[model samples]
Target: MAGPGGRMMAGGGPGQRSIDFKGSSKRLIARFRPERATICALLACVVLSVGLSVIGPKILGRATDLVFAGIVGRDMPEGATKEQVLESMRERGDGEVADMLRGTDFTPGEGIDFTAVGDVLLFALGVFLVAGLLMAVATRLVNRAVNHTMFRMREDVQTKLSRLPLSYFDKRQRGEVLSRATNDIDNIGQTLQQSMGQLINSLLTIIGVLAMMFYVSWILALVALVTVPLSFVVATRVGKRSQPHFVQQWRSTGTLNAHIEEMYTGHTLVKVFGRQEESAKRFAEENEALYEAGFKAQFNSGVMQPLMFFVSNLNYVLVAVVGGLRVASGSLSIGDVQAFIQYSRQFSMPLTQVASMANLVQSGVASAERVFELLDAEEQEADASPAERPDEPRGRVALERVSFRYDPEKPLIEDLSLAVEPGHTVAIVGPTGAGKTTLVNLLMRFYEVSGGRITLDGVDIARMSRDELRSGIGMVLQDTWLFGGTIAENIAYGAAREVTREEIEEAARAAHADRFIRTLPDGYDTVIDDDGSGVSAGEKQLITIARAFLSDPVILVLDEATSSVDTRTEVLIQKAMAQLAHGRTSFVIAHRLSTIRDADTILVMENGSIVEQGAHTELLAADGAYARLYKAQFAQAVAEVD
Candidate 1:
């Protein structure tokens, strides 16, 4: 849904949106398929580890019984059978002690057997030690599998982004998309790392401990089972309630990040327009929204732990009381009752742990959904198979009744027909919202033409692969983009193959960037960031021109390429561009009329139509739209000069 400022909100909006928990969690698990072997090993470790851990309490019970039986036997007289001593005790009206003693196996007059107790204790310790070792191994395996899955997911996202159409990015904030790729993915990884192994172990432990509990005493086991349903209900209800908040939390994060990115990037603009307070207010609003979403998510999920703990304590008390009565009746031994109590605790601990992890799982799945949404996004149309190319590879391009619209209902470029001969310079000039750049965009197939076919040397461009079409063209856009690299590397970026230092320098010289580069601290080797921080706007423009120069493409496009440069540099660029355009088809979209007075052809565009077309002198003599634009610009220049 669209929100204020046309920002998209998948889950964070005025009304909270429910998450597809089951589907998203299943998809997240499916991502680990490539690590199937590791997962299987981890499961093996967990199963064996849990088996040993469950048996440890039973073995410890034997040790307890040995010590306890010795204490009971030590109080009895020698030379009498175990039944005789118990019968005498009952006769003396010590019936409770006698009943409890009937379950013990010990020699009369024997004291606590330290040796037997030590041996049993050692066995129990060994069982637990091995279990702990196996659990550690399982943890390592889980980490490996989770990390591998996350690595592949990142790769998939990166590959997916490259296939998405320009329009997809045009409509979305860069930061919003970036959050999916970085923050959301990272959150998922962290959650999985923290929860996946433990969740598996907790589940297995519950099953194992439940079995042990039933083995010790079925009655106590039944008592422990009473609270199981309650724990599950608590977990599910709290999880469901908190899930939407988790979804909103991540959505708010993306929105806040998008706002911050926009504000930071345009901080100078905000200050220039004296809108600092407005920007700050907007930030506070987004920040507050994120805080609320996060708080609610945590609070709701947070309630699960204490509630589960309460249910577990209730189960514990019930088992303890019931086991005591069974021991008193001689139905179960004291050691057996003790072991049953331990089993009950083990069972409840997993339940409590899983309940506590409800929020973490919800949060992780929320992030996974965001990433899956990106992966599921519609991609650009596939490239043509058995692609066609221009036979002669000349720089001739023609738009035959081409039409296009960003919105299907609103046309931007309609029936725009034009043909450029090999090596001719065509200059496009128009007011804002004119179809000037849109024409170049179609010619390059940045956008598919809606109504008619655009062709290169008579072969329809749509029939060719985008890479094949773009490889033949070099463009210097009005808004320059420079990756963080040396100046030489930036210039060489236009070339398809590796370029030499001398060649890079020669291209820079042609674009009039070499002089300023040499004046910088590290000359051509100086590195700038993505935003071209170290270079002036004109210098950035010059570097882009240099990049285009290095490509030496058959077709060239300059979209206000010299708009930032001073008049002196513009004259130098014009001279260099003339030499560059000597035998290549060139398309220049210029706002400055003086720059294209000598072009072979001039087009005046307005509202998606070519209103006038001629040579500069011809159009000026005809006194058409082109003449008026030129005259207006000339008067403006005169006024500025005065």
Candidate 2:
């Protein structure tokens, strides 16, 4: 079964697929190993900030005590000692007031002490100010750490792509792969940035607030924790339900992206075929699937916050009731109860905050899973050390009993052998899927042969690094590829070393592309997109041929190199290829029987084997597969002319 972001596994949707929460979380954290130093600094700042914040409420509690004491103390006789005033209240049947008064340290003759209170308030303010400053620093560190981690991840992804075999891409959509590299990685970064620092702060605040609560009054502390189990239940239940949806959401995102990319790239074909409505219907279906998955994921996770808030409010009532009782019973001061109330809030808030962020954390982890899957995919076999070089570049290429298959049960090419001597041009003529392209692929090492081996200059090609082997060969296929650059730069891309402007122009002239290039507004300097937007199909074909010419390869392989060009241009390209083929080995795969009559060898391939091979004249005289194909093309041409 193909996994997420490749193709959906058959018979399994999001609900049927469960994620390893602990495993994904651990792996995601492991990606941050390079940023550990920055993380340590961030943690230190958070710890200090939370420590000071937890202390702030306690300091304010002291000021609260002073004011309460002043009010009570002012009602007592001015001349009396503090003990006598409390005794007087007890005797007068104001026993509850006396009990509450016992917990405060107040002078009977005094009122509010503004100066002392101001000092306490100022110290609390300073602590909070420092805490905020430290948190700000921590946030900056968070950004730094996350950005660095993301940068490395992108680099890793790019490197992995280069190392992967072509088959990996063949089995997957370009947009899906791109979504994992771009959207998924970006999501992971945003998730970490949004949650990491805040999670740390919330947790530290919880711990610090718990300690302060215990210090203030154990009874009230126990009261504030009464609903903690309930909060945990709500969080886990909602989180569990939402987790699958998050996975599905990302999966759907990749699928939708793949559909959109496929459609956009083939939009011209769709319009030509009048399939616009059908395409829209398919797009709508994918979009709705994404919306459904996203909506369910969000709605399920969204339930956590309100449920957590309910638990917190319940805890609040318990603390308030128990705290008031403690104050009335003289077991705790009013100011202590007030501070305990703030501590209860501090304790509940992190739990609530974490619960609310369930969706973000879940979403990020889902993206992390996707990215890790890409990274973990089996890469192509490592390139070997270069084989011992031949005495010189002779380009004598041979394949002995090469076998290959895209699927194990279906053999596409089996036990194939071919040899081309140095300085010879070999033309391969075959119907579609007859392994003409597959043969060249094996030669280029795009796909390794399943059995036996291929050799260049008497050295096993597999023993050499892929780059080392392919660097000596030049390829121009019917489907040309050009990057977004000027015509000069695009052509120059073929050369392994820097080339002079004269050399570039000469190569273009050789390919018959120089005339058209010179007519453009900027000549060879005119820029084009990767799709070669400014050039016609045949013009693009000519530029690619020019590119191949610039490479000046030791071995040239052309697969329908002139398929896009007009008859006049095809003749010109053929002349250029013939000149380039001098003193080097050349392999041409073509369907046009007329173009390759002068080749030193003509190979007729069918069903992955060479059915007939010789000079074109000899094959025609033999009246075999090559002659039959040639006669068929001749008849088609005569019919068209008539």
Candidate 3:
């Protein structure tokens, strides 16, 4: 089930789950191999600590037996001491009693040897103190190792994301990617930090306690071992049942987060469309699913601890009864019985802990599998050996028999050819989904052409490195994006080299954004929120235009750049665009027929094919597709005027 951070609860249950415990564990262990020295030291400390723990109870039992013997000796026949009682036993020819009391150091009148008991207690205290110190050191070492490994893991994930192609992101939800990067990584980190050391120590404790239990009495050890298989069976059954639910839980959580992000970002549209109730209903459905999954996972996994506790208590009862019988029969001494009982509990304690941690361990493996999936995703193909870089690039560009399809079965553009010389404007006009922006994406190398070549002045763009090709091009998209930074920073974002404050202002002025900037409370220094919430859409577009201007690119791509502005502002932006495109090649993708009427060339695209291409007036004179589109827009404009 989903947790507070929208993470799935531990132990994802069955059905085509991707969790490979053995494989993931091996990889996880390989990641820690570099810290083997520290791990070894930590293990050494665990051994020492558990060794001390195992011996302490046995030593304490000796003290208990001494006290009992002293009490019995002093209370015998009206305050006779241990030495006197032994002498009386010898005088009465009780050889067995004399031998039993041989090592009991007791004074004639005292009930117990306070000095010897104090010494044994002090020694046990010292052992525990050292064990505590070792454990503290081990804990610190574990933290350091775990944090270091996770730090490197996060770095790898970040680097891997940068190397992945845009297609990878196109196929997945943003929230799903984010969940893997943040929540899943954090899960791995927490599990390693919390469970890794405990697992090691518990295992060692179980082994040591078993050995000590057998050393005390094999029959009692067998009684304790009886409950172990039962505990394992229960834990395994519960864990197997809970695993799939955990997977579903995380999958639903990712979906829910994606939905929330979409709704929040588009809340304006939701309210405008009167979809609040519908949105709330969708959220409730997701929330209820998360709750149900979470409850089942938690309930199934949660029962493990109590079930293990019952087995432990059952083992405890068996040990007590069996050991009491041995003690009464003189097969086991009172001291041995006490020590055996403590050992039995100690042995079962780790079993209980491991049983309870079964779910967490499984959850960690699931998280690891998800993380590995991202890491193992197909990255962008590397550039060819000895990749070429454009030198002294000209603004000339050509699309030679270009063909593309988002899906191979449904071809979009086929055998398309185009060429633009330096210092010319090419206006591409089309309806929505007519592959207008797709052409721009191909030009920018955001997506490679399916079967064709796009070339710069002479060299094919496919041969040049993506960074080199993109470095000479500038783009302004329909959806303006401004990061959370000062207004000047957004404007200066286009420049690869450092830009001076004066240059930033000049670009803004050219884009007709300077007047609005000066009116703001902080002007160019004003901090923009992530969504640029306080800024008008037109203003945001202007800022992006200014950024493109500052970049001084040899080729410019403006796709719906002026779509958000008012008519007056559009006129200003068009003037700015004219100046920006004066000495550079530009591709202008626009929907408005009036806007591209002055273009040097206009290409009318329909269904991903160029139906008409010519100067605006020429196309209108031919009375082709462009002519019909212009007539429709012209009629709409006149209707508005009337």
Candidate 4:
């Protein structure tokens, strides 16, 4: 939908929060309820596992206390007791001592029962097992949800790209858009699936583990938790430093991708000019920048785990010394001391995870920001009301005082007016920057006009649904684009109804593409890769023309459709153009005078204004801009032939 300043909002969809992260996480988290459920389950596992794990240490400590109590019963002196005998006896009575491990009033089977303790141990083991499995399930669920959302995001971005104002692409590099569509999306997918998944689990696990730690011993819990804030501060520092680095890395890669794409597209020109060294030098610089950025970012992130561990170890040492003193003073039980250490680790582990996730979280945030930016781009204006769609549209187009500009400061099409009656052919000819293509752009609503208006059968085009307006008109671009698909599929690109073989052949024949199709081994079924393959440039252009032909639009736009084709192909395309122009309104942008010689009206634009307009003979009689351009262009053509 439209937003402030009449900009189209493409950033967020259903359940998506705004790109800004300030207070946005709360909304994003709420929208991600399924992922939140997985987080909760992970927390359950963490709490359960931590609780069960502490029991082992408690059991060992209880056994120690029981042995100490027995020695006191035997009236053995601490200094006079034989160390070897104590050790040997303790080993032999290990199972029994643990069974009778009681804090007080341990005369017989009053406080501690070894049999019931065995049951407790088994229960703890079972809890740990179940928790592990639940944790695994939570992980799988989180990944599934994240991946599904990311896939949808990629798809949505692509769709928006397709519908965006054509001017949006004018100032952008193809490589940069390509990188965002492919590489940026891929990075985001990995972060959400692998890294963000763990981050969510870790957050919940930390909360649960800390709760258990406090429940066991608040004093020890406090001691264990001291590392939390410390680690967090350190992580924040490192994360801040690394976040920008990663963003830069992403940008640098986009630049590199752009360079690569440009090189590949112009490989023949580069070779002809013998500029391999210059290209290699540029690539080397890009590669070196990428390597440095990657190394620094990873190295900084790597230091987090070790730094956190060092803090954890310090906390561990303090807990052991302080807890041991409390136990010796009889203020704490041996089991309590043992459980404290386990809880301490549980408390610190999540902190470690939080530290580690800083890298991924930052990367994800950066990517999300970029994706949201694209989605936030302005969309063309909506129609005032839905126009009545026709099964077969009438061929009438009028440009009344139509003016446009890529930028407001410079007008491309001045306040010029033109009209095409039903079944009429209009040709536009101009110098390189004379707004020839800009006329087609406005008619297609690829960009809104700066002034005046254009209409189809007296109904203002701006008041018509973009889809209905475009569907009524067919376009053949100068540069033909074919996706990786079968020739038949490409030919039937935008037709709503399924195209029959006969219809496909008919369109192909009209475009003079049928000859090439039959020459291919697979004919219409020939599978083509995105790379130039199994077809010539002229053949591809013909196929695109055939696609437009199959749509059966009442108005046709040919933007230098035959400019890139060979002489023979041009003749064939010219014949096809004549047939396609019959019984329809057609707009042709041609640099070649020969192609537009027979057009009913020829409008020559210069500096965004129509300086010459009339029939061929009429323009020549006026001896204005059109006549000069014709003579200059035609003279070069004759010289080239000679």
Per-candidate TM-scores read 0.97, 0.97, 0.92, 0.86
Q: lDDT score, residue 159, model 3? A: 97
Candidate 1 lDDT tens digits, 30-131: 889999999999999999999999999899889889988998889889888899998998899999988877898988988999998999999898999999
| Regions of candidate 4 where Cα sits further than 4 Å from its true position | 1-117, 388-392
Candidate 3, residues 1-642, lDDT tens digits: the string is 655676433323335454667888899878988798989999999999999999988989888887876786575775665667777888999866666555545555556888988998999899989988988888988998899889998999999998898889999988778888888889889988888888989999999989988888999999999998998898889887887666666666666777787788889999999999999978877766667666776778888899999999999999999987776655777788899889988888898888788777767777787888999999877765677765777789899999999888999898899999888999999788888999999998778899989988877888888888888998999999999999999999999999999999999999999999999999999999878977999999999999999999999999999999999999989988999999899999998978777788898888888989999989989998998988998899999999
* Pairs of colliding residues, candidate 1: none
Clashes of each: 0, 0, 9, 5
Model 3: lowest-lDDT 10 consecutive positions: 7-16
Per-residue lDDT for 335-380 in model 4, tens only?
6777777767766777887787767766666666666677778865
Q: Write down the worst ten-residue block by lDDT for model 2.
A: 2-11
Q: Which sections of candidate 2 miss by over 4 Å?
A: 1-12, 386-388
Error of 4 at 477 (Å): 1.9
By summed lDDT, the worst window of 10 consecutive residues in model 1 runs over 6-15
Per-residue alpha-carbon lDDT of model 2 for 83-171, expressed as tens digits?
89888889999999888778898888789888889999999999999999999999999999999999999999999999888899999
